[model samples]
Each structure stands twice: as C-alpha cells, then as structure tokens.
Target: MSSSAEDPNKQPTLYDSSSSTSQPLLSKLNTEEPTIRPDPPDPDPEPTQFLQISYNHGPRPFKDLPFLILFALFVLSTFAFGIFLIFNRNPNHGNVSSYTYDTNSSSCVDDSLNLSLLLSSNNWVLFNNELSSSDFLEYLIWTLVVTLILSVPFCFLVLLLLKHYTKQIVYVSLPFFVLFPIFFDVYWFVACTVSSSCGDSFPLLYRILVLVFVFLIIGVVVWIFVANWHRIELTVNIIGVASYALSRNLGLFVVLPLLALGLVFYYAPIVVFLVFARLNGKIVPKESDGEYSCVWRQDSWVPFYYALGILTMLWSYTAMVEAQAYVISGTIAQWYFSKEDSRPRLSIRSTLRNAFGPSAGTICFSGLLVCAVRLVRAAVDSAAEEVPGFVNFALRCCVNALLASVDFLNKFTINFAAITGEAYCSSARMTYELLKRNLLSAVFVETVSTRLLAGIIFVLSTIYAIAVFAILKGVAKLGVDSYFVAALAWVLLILVLGFFVNVLDNVIDTVYVCYAIDRDRGEVCKAEVHEVYVHLPISRSHRSSIVPRPLGV
Candidate 1:
C-alpha cells in the first residue's frame, strides 16, 4: 500500500518539540513550518501524510497533586469533626429522650443525643413527617422523578430543534431575550403609575431609580448583540455542528445526569455534617423570656468548621461540573477527529478513564479556584449589606468582574485540557495562545448559544411546571402547597435540561479547538465540519500573513 493510504495511527511518531519548550502542547499535532531534513537513501521511499497522536496508557502521573491531597484532607477532617459532634453528648442533657412516635404528646420532641436521628438529617425527617400532613415531600420527590423521566425525550426534541432550526432559534430567541426584560420593566412602571393598588407600594423615586437601572442594563445588552452581529453566522454554524455531534453521541445525555446523581450522593454526607453541626450546639435558656435556644458552643473552631463545610460543598460541586465538561470534551474530540464515512468506534469509557482516572487532580485544581472566587463573592455580599458605600460597591464590581473573567477563560481551558491531557496551568496558557492566534473570541458564541439554550429551557420548564400545577390543584385537590410541588418540578426540569445544554456548550468549545488545530496543521480532520467552520472570519491582520488555504482549496 502507498504511504498516503497507511493507517496514520500506526506510523512512527515525531518527537513533540512542545515537550521540551514552552510551546502549546497541541501545536505539536502539526507544525506550521516543517523542518528540513536529508532524504533517506531508500529508492522505494513513498511520501506519507500523517499526524502523530499518542494515546495515554495506564495511569499517568497526577497533575496538581498537592491540591488533590489538600481537598482529600479537608473531606476527611470535616467528616471526622461531624462524627465527633454527633456522638459527643451534651453534659447538661442527662436524660433527653430518643425521638420516637408519641401519639399522646403534642410538644416538640427533644432528642439531644440520638446520633442516628441527627445523622438521618432534615430530608429524611421531612419525608417522614410531611407524608402525614400535606405530603409535600412525597409530592416533591414524585415531581422531580417525573421531570427526570421527561427530560430524556425533551432533550432529544431540543437536539432535533437545534439541528433543524439553528438560525431561526438564534434570531427569534435573541429578540425575545432583549425585549422581554424591557417589556417587563415598562409594564411594571406603567402598572405602578396607573393602578392605585400597587401605586402606593412603589414610591416615585424608587420607581424612577429602577427604570434608570433597567435602561442601563438593556443598553449594555443591545451593545453586545450589535457588536457581535458579524459573528452570529459563525456561532450558528458551530451550534449546528455541535447539535449534530450530540445527536451522534446520544449516550452523552446519560453521562451528565449520572454525574449529577453521583454529586447528590456525595452531598448526602456533607448535609449530615451540616445538620449535626447545628444539633451539636448547646441549648441555652433565655433569661428574659425563659425560652431556650440552641447556641453553638463558644469555640473558635466552630466558625472555622462552618466555613470549611461551605467550601467543601462549593469545591465538590465545581469539581463535579468540571469533570462533566472534561468527559464531554473528550468524547466530542474523539468524534471530531474521526473519518466521516468510516469513523472508528468511539468509547465514552476510554474518555471517562482519561478524565477521572488520570486527570482528576487537574479537575480538583480548577474547582479550587472557582470555590475561592465564590467564597470571595459571598464575603463581598455580606460586607455590602454591612457597609453600603461607594467604595464597597466598587470593590464588589471589580471582584465580580474578576470572577466572570476566570469563569469565561476556564471554560476553554478545561476543554483544551481534556483534549491535550495537560495540567491546568499549562493547558490555560496554551488555550489562550491558540485562541489568540485564531482571532476567535469565545465571547461571541457565549452571548448567543448559551442564552438561546437557556431561554428555550426556561420556557419549556415553566410550561411543564404550570401543567403539573394544574393537575395537582385541579385533579388531586391539593392546596397551596401544590405551588411548591410545581416549583420543585420546574427546578428539576431546568437542571436536567440545563445539563444537556451544557454538553452542547462543551461540544462547541471542543469543535472550535479541533478546528483551530486542524487549521493550524493544514489538515482537515472532518471535511464537512471544516467546510462550515472555514467561513469563520479572519481578522485582516493575520489574513495577510501566510493563511494556509483550508483543506482541498
């Protein structure tokens, strides 16, 4: 067989220069300018076309190992402290009774030292109690179950809609996104002015201030859309390809929900720790009114434990989210590099192995950064309430801006990490340089695809919630608590559907990075995708300097 027709995956690999230098790791996929070497003496030498890609085998060295160790230590210490708090009996409560069914009594049951009861936590308690009263907890569980059941088919429907109506959805949703807030503000203002009922509630000055703020926000939205109008076509194409890729990898839908379920299980122990923390406090009787209150023991470590618990929750949640992104990106990158007609079988198992098995530390490191930002935001919010001033407001704005920038950059950084298997810092630097070279701002698609998906999910979830509300109230004869049931349904549907959209967002990032690599290497990994993405407008500065004609041009 001719060398051109040889399986590229079997060829001897060229040593990557990126391993030795600070160059972007993925740039090794293809060199922009090939180094010259003397031709081999073999007269039968055949020209070959190949891209050297290596598959990672077994377990690789952990990236960001210290962060992983720190997170594990925190998890262990928090659980140990929670266990101590639960088992440690309050010396003052000598004979506090264990919680049991006492039909004859109507007072609050004081089960101070029952470790099992405290560990069972609020959810189980609420489930048992609410079963008899309004059955609110039961209804909520059923509502969430129904939402999960419906979300699978609903996501497939969304994929179909996006595939067929990408342009229509973007054009239509962008208008609604812009106009809805404006209309809402205007209607509220007019209602306050015309209706005596609400008119007395909102003072003139307050109403005027709200209107001014709303106008400023709308102005910013309009400016962003107008500025990126040129890039909307490219965004539509990317979303279209993403929808197609998602459709091909239908199993991706399950990956995220399963990850989410795992996340819920992870939180169960944390929830127990939080509940037991409060229960561990001592009961102090009030001197003024003789009422008793559970006051946390005056230990310095108590406050620190609370803070640690919060950080643990946020960090674990963020890490789980990053893991999801990594899995999706890895899967999509596999699909992107495959041949259109004769693509190899893609295995999400391998992708999962790479993401969670080898690169788990990278996910932990990224999650820590996000968790720290959230901690800062929470502190700023508290301070804002305590010290309401210009300086405080300015600080809050600057901090929030920093948070947004990190989040935006992290999205692609994680995607690139998924592709290259590099550590977080190295992947971040490389991803930034690649995007800069391509002149592709991640901001344009962020404004369009995410908002459009969010609008669709919101509308569908709200409609579904309302339909459930009607059934609960009209058919089941439920009372006001039916609203709560419907609201729970709404949140679940949004969460499930939002997970699906998140997969698509990761697909977009993966495709763009793949395209950047394909463009850089002067090879087309997938021709149809390249044809569509090739239309991405290049800035004039780079267009003049040796822009390689896209594959087959």
Candidate 2:
C-alpha cells in the first residue's frame, strides 16, 4: 500500500498535519501560549538619565585662613595701640581740673579746713569708698567665673537634651549650636573693643582662652558646613526660586497686590486718624506715632525714603526669583529633551504646562481680585467723612478681621498644599480643610490658631487701649503738666503687658503644634525623609585590601 492511501489511520489529524508541515505551524501557535516562549528579550531597558545639579559646597578649605591670620594681627595691633594710648595719655585728663568761683558770691573767704580734721572726720567714709572700688572689681571677676561655670553645665545639659531628641532638635537647635561660635565671636569682639577703649588691659590668660575658642569655633564651623552641605544647597535653590519669581512677576503679582492691600488696611487707617484729628482741631501725630505723612513733606520724607528702600529690596528679591525660575526651567527642559524614552519628554511638557501655563493665569487673576477688593475698600473709606464712630469702628474691625482671616488662609493653603503635594484651586476649600484638620486635634486648635487667636488679641488690644486712654485722661485731670509722663506710663504699661501676653501665646501655640503634628498624627507632614549619602566608616585594613586595578591595556 502507498503511504498516503493505504490506511484510514495514516490520514493525519488537522493539528498533526499542521505540525508536520515544513513551516512548523504548531511552534508558531505555541509561541502565543502563556507557559511557552520567553518574554521577547525585554528590549534592553532605556538607561536612566541622571540630573546634574551644581552648587557651592562650602567655603574653600583655606579661603578664611587669610582672614583668620589678618584678624589675629589686627587684634594684636589693636591691643598694642590701646596700651600705648592708655600709657601715653595724661591721667589728669579724667580728674577734676579746678573749681569755678561764682562772681556773685557775697564774700570770698579762706575756708580751707585743716588737713588733719578733713582726714579724721570723713576718714571712715573715704576708706569705705576706696574699698568699694576693689570690692566691685572682685565681685565682677567672681560673677564672670560663676557665669562661665554655670554655662558649662547648661551647655552639657543642652547637648544631652539634643541627643535625646535629636530628630526634633536637629532642625531648630542644631543650627543655633553650630552658629553659637559666630555669636560668641561677635560678643567677644564687642567686649574687647569696649574694654580696650576704657583702658582695661587684655590679660594673657584671656588671650589664650580666645585663641582656643577660635580654634574650636573653626572646627565646629567646618563640621557644620560638612554636615549640612545638601541643606545649604537646597536653601540656596529655594532662595533662587523666590528671587526669580519676584523679578519676573513683580508688579503683576507681588508689589501691586501688597501695596494695594497695605494702602487699604494700613495706610487708610492712618489717613482716617489724621482726618479725624484735623476735623477735631487736634494736632496730628508724627510718623513715630503711626500717622501717615505725605511724601512731599520734609518731615515725612525720611519715612518715605525708608519705604522706598524696602520697595527696592522687594523688587530685587523678585528679580532673584525670576532668575532661579529660569535656571530651574532650563535644567528641567534639558533633562527632558535628553531622555532616551519619549515618556519623560511627555511628562516634562505636562509638568511645564501645569506649572507655568494656566495655573499662573489663575494665580494672577486671584491677586487682581484681591487688589480690586482692597481698592474698593480704600475708595469707600476715603469718600466717607460723616460716618458714625460705631460704624467706622465696625468697619475697621471687619477689615482687620478680614485681613487676619486672609493671612491665616494663605498660610494654611501653603502648608496643606506642601504637605499633600496636591494643588488646591479653591482658597475657601483649602481654608475649610485647614480649619477642619486643626479643630480635629485639640492641641492643634490650642496652639497655632492664628486667625481666631489674632482676632481675640485685637479685641483685647482695643480694650487695653481704651483703658489706657481713660487712665491717662484721669491723670491729666489731676493737674499734671507733663504729657511725657502720661505717654511714658501708657507705653510702659502696653510694653510690659504685651510682651508677657505675646510670650505666653507663642509658647502655648508652639508646644501644642509640636505635640499635634508629631505625637498625635504620627506623620510628620512638615518634614520629609531625605536620603543622604555619607561615607561609611571603613577600617584601614579593608581600605588597604582594596587593591588598584590596571588599565585594560
């Protein structure tokens, strides 16, 4: 029988026939099977592009060495100069030269007491006075020693506290500790200068102590610089960003809005006060008393100049922000364009579009809206003259309340957006969330409730001012001729009361906020986990064992 026609069993099934074919169809079909062929070689993954960011690491190793040497020479030169100045000068320069005689005296008599009588009668008083100088010097020296001794234990205690709460302490306290030397140097220089000017000698022991302090300060500075290199860079970057923003969008977003707001909330009130004074035939207060003076007036020009300088600084800061923005944008653009995959290119465009496109317009629009509101309020206040005191007071209160609310809202929105990395378009919504989140935690509400607390503070301040006015008016009715006395009393009372109140509020707020965020939530939204690359401490043996390899030649 022929192979193809002999038996029915010899006729292949469809699958078998296809498998036996020269094309090997079954293998092709199996390629699609889940269990079968290898994953198409994974197409060599695109290389991950790295970002190159350059920054000033720290002062050059020996940049300050020359300064240090110069400073040392200056100190020595000053010390020598001071000694020469002291020794060469006449001691009698400070002494009473002569007693002046009045021509109108009825008689001139030889009234000189006997030397022995003068010595004996006031001898104890003279001796006590002489010893008082020595006693003061001894006391001063003892006090200094005691202060230094106390500081040592205090410093040690602070160090222990820092170590115990390193995570919390590092952000705020460590910087202060690192910068303490700089502060100490300033204090020392001032002290030395004052002493040298007053004919006090710089002791050898003090000089040695200062030299040791200098070296220790240098070491501490170096350690801090090394430890916070990345942080320093980040701070620079942030400053740059702010500067760039300020420069590019100055009048449109920052200056105009701020000026407009100030005109409405701050200057307008001063103007109202001035108008009230003029109408009531009272003398308008000076700039020092918070009255607005026109720029053209000579007396007011100094304050105007000061304001101009501040405005100039703001402009300069804006320019810096613009520069930083440009730099960052250029860097991001370059990075995106240089990527191997198209995905990153798309992402970069999207990011830019989101950051600098429609969102910017929205921000500007919001600023304009705020400016318009401020302008309207100013216009209304300016136009009104016969407004009732209660109405005016209510209006002022409303304005202040609004400003406080807005400021709080601004802060809350910024913090919330930063924490979430999510842009919230609605300010009202953001404010609500902020209020809700804070209220949820009793501690948070107690501490950091700026808007509510500020409102309360304003009310209390108004009440205090009224009380002060009443007291001063009552005192004036008591036949006092001096306005200075009344003013002094008023100022002293406010200062003493305000300082304590502010301190108490700040302490409570700070403690509560810290507890709320750190202890209550267990999520530190304000702080981010930063990955730092530090050189692992390697033993000399391990380092030595790492042999150098030859070139591929």
Candidate No. with top TM-score: 1
**Ten-residue region with minimum lDDT total, candidate 1:** 45-54
What lDDT would each prediction earn against the true structure? 0.74, 0.36
TM-score of candidate 1 versus the correct structure, residues matched by position: 0.72
lDDT of candidate 1 over 54-78, digit per residue (tens): 2233356668778788889988888
lDDT per residue (tens digit) for residues 1-553 in model 2: 6655545557644355434455555776787788855656325321211111121112212222332343334334434433443344332221111212223552222333346554566998888778776633444344345434443343334334422442343345335443545665666656665676422576656655775788686686567556655554333222222222222222222322343354346334333333222222112212436433211112232344334333333332332232222223322322222323332234223433432332333222233334444555665576455575777778867876776565445433322222222333543364343333333322223332222223233333334444444654564442322333333433443343343233223322222223223322333322211111011112233223222122121
Q: Which segments of model 2 are wrong by more than 4 Å? A: 1-210, 224-327, 330-357, 361-553
- True-structure RMSD for candidate 1: 14.3
- Candidate 1, position 371, lDDT: 77
Per-candidate clashes come to 0, 13
Q: What is the TM-score of each candidate against the true structure?
A: 0.72, 0.22
